[model samples]
Target: MSKEAQFSTDKFRLDGKVAIITGGASGLGFNYTKAMLISGAKVVIASYDEKGWDETSKFAKSVNGEVKFIKIDVTAKEAPDIIVNAALSKFQKIDILVNNAGMQRRNNSVPI
Candidate 1:
């Protein structure tokens, strides 16, 4: 009897794909970046905080993942161009884009 192939995250593999993840330097965005890398996709992390890049870089290296990063506020008018250019410059083509960049400000704490 022929052996059946196993169903796993391999079914969701993104080999040879390139992705741009906004806010990928921290929070939920960071998790998305890690997952994409593990799935064989090269990732470009676009974030507002430059400091997060270092941390993301460390994790990428530990996983032997291919990653690049750019620091720019997603709210800027030129952000789209900047991010697209950055991704194209390194990976040549973009296959996936994660629009995960945003910010929030709390004016008051909840009453106990």
Candidate 2:
């Protein structure tokens, strides 16, 4: 039996890659957004929180990476197209996708 090891330095580079993230205004989504930016990836965040959007955009600008926020409800039927188009219009190509938008509601006991 023979063992072989291979490594490529280019695998870690994200230069010229575009990423679209949903629910990226805060929480885990926000963290992922920052990490991607630090790795040299252009990011577009789609969220429903206006204030968070503004703040995240400002923060992203400070980091010197291309970032954009688009207010959208991911539940909407047309949301996918809108997001895809936005990313394409801005960066011309999308190399990654981060679908992180979701919500949960408390459940009440049903009347029997």
All predictions: root-mean-square deviation over Cα? 7.5, 8.5
- Model 1: runs farther than 4 Å from truth? 1-8, 105-112
Model 2 ranges off by over 4 Å:
1-11, 106-112
TM-scores for all predictions: 0.81, 0.78
Residue 77 Cα positional deviation in candidate 2, in Å, after optimal superposition? 0.5
Summed backbone clashes in each candidate are 0, 0
lDDT of each: 0.85, 0.81
What's the residue-level lDDT of 87 in candidate 2? 88
lDDT of 2 by residue, 58-87 (tens): 767876788978888987899999999988
The per-residue C-alpha lDDT of model 1 at residue 54 equals 81
Q: Per-residue error at 8 for model 1, in Å? A: 4.8
What is the alpha-carbon lDDT for the whole of candidate 2?
0.81
- In model 2, state the lDDT of residue 105: 57
